[model samples]
Target: MNAEKPPGSKQALVIIGMHRSGTSATTGALRCLGVDLGNRLYKGHEGINDKGYFEHSDLADANDEALSALGSSWDDILLRQENWWKREELIPFAARIRSHIRKDFANSSIWAVKDPRVCRLLPWWLEIFDSERISPRFIFVIRSPHAVFRSLERRDGFSMEKSFLLWSLHYLEAEQWSRNFPRAFVDFDRFIEHPAQELARVEETLGISFPISVENAAPCLNQFLSRDLRHHQERESPESSPVLSLTHALHQSLLGAVDSGQPDSLEMDALWNKMESIQSGFPRALVEHIRSSGSIQGNLQITMNRLMRSWSWYTGKPVRFLERLAGRNV
Candidate 1:
């Protein structure tokens, strides 16, 4: 076996995957393995993700802005051209990311950054890394489509088909975007079941051994990767659409890739090509609006109208009082 990473290793482990796909969990596991995940991670909600998100909020916010600058968002099923991340609007954010790396991980080595958004924003990150002379290794998390759907449905009210589409886009794009880089895939279930085995696989692929062994980190992993932490179990469900069938197949391939150490894009190439061809029509206009706003438009509009009415009543109160006094004097 190879020696563990030294104190001077500049390896940045980039963890990417679709939301509700265990990217957070993988990040947590990596943290237990002695990866520096920074101090500004997102807070964990009670029922949603009690073990903490393990996502760097700063990078996550910048990622949101990068997507917004392109008139896209995390939930939008549409993917922009690779050049979109190169736009002027994204430059400042890229610089911010660079500054963040310099300041936060100044004395650290073998630090990890985990954000599901990175699955789509890898192109931008690659450019940033090139300028910083930093090396990046990718770890993609995979979960069952049905489990992801159930989790997203509970958290975001997303439909099954929409969940399938988002899952496909994130995974396929992450795979395509990071093809040239050092990357590995881990199944969420397997990681939870046997984190030591998964970490060994990661070490083999990424060429960097963790400072701490999984055996040493067993206490932490046992607590963090509890069965309760995984809210949804993998329930095999029928795929109603051809696109969904492709998504399901892609997911299965990812699970296989975990063992084979190859995503086997040869078989997935046609499926991804077809997915991109038909993606424009998957989430229709109204659906796109919902994704961008992060809520249902009709409900939001109704809430706005009520606020306006209340404001109108408050502003008109003095005038109504004056009118009433004038009438009484008359």
Candidate 2:
């Protein structure tokens, strides 16, 4: 954290979006604008996300633990229950979040945190923010559901149907939770094509300014928001398919509202209803399949680790004996 306060310093910027939906790029762009992402950032995996995730590790871990307490994980489409905020378990999680803020962001005036898991956990975070007297600004990044589905398939081995539902679940939660806060929506495709314009819109809409000038930020933006970074591009509009039409409609509506500077709650509510209707009919078999696969994968990994340990233990003496023999022969 920097000692000096920058112009238009916000208390915190929370970037909310589904996984593989350009949250990392949005966070990286904000970092260029001089938003502190705290000292401990998730470097992100090499092949999956060569560019950094820009999410604080302590906060992210806390969110993971919080999700687990709520009977959810990052991969689960069904996040917390409707009344999750009232759960007694969240009390400790909120305390942990407060400690993390004190430890990681104590010296910063304007810091940002981005994690896809935060989409569903906003209620928990909001409680902490209110208790701690921290004002939060939100940035929601949305990509076409088709693109998100493809990316999830390649990365997580998720089925197209499961991915679509997960994307819908995340965005629905984000929209519902973030309505009270000052928020700006960035279309991932448009942001990639014209990052400066989108970021400028975010600044103006949120009533915050970047610490650095657009000229300085431009170079960093170029380095971060390149076309090659986008792994999945929608071949046809998501609206063209029945499975993705609701997501596409909701995303377009949110984007329109953000651009017009007035988000329509009634329209958003209607969209949510429609989405819920569709999701009600989502196949239970698919959900079970995904969960079963995950369990099998975890079990296989544990079995492999046990086997490797056993092999090492059994072969240790013989290997050492062979090494001594080789040394004597030499």
Over the stretch 223-255, how does candidate 2's per-residue lDDT look in tens digits?
778887788888554234444776667767767
lDDT of 1 by residue, 119-219 (tens): 77877787787777777888988889889999999999998888888999888877876777677888888888888888888988989878788789888
Score residue 204 of candidate 1 by CA lDDT. 87
Cα lDDT computed for each candidate against the true fold: 0.78, 0.75
Could you tell me the lDDT of residue 266 within candidate 2? 80
The lDDT leader among the candidates is 1
Q: Stretches of candidate 2 above 4 Å error?
A: 1-10, 237-243, 279-330
TM-scores, each model vs. reference: 0.83, 0.80
The collision pairs in model 1 are none
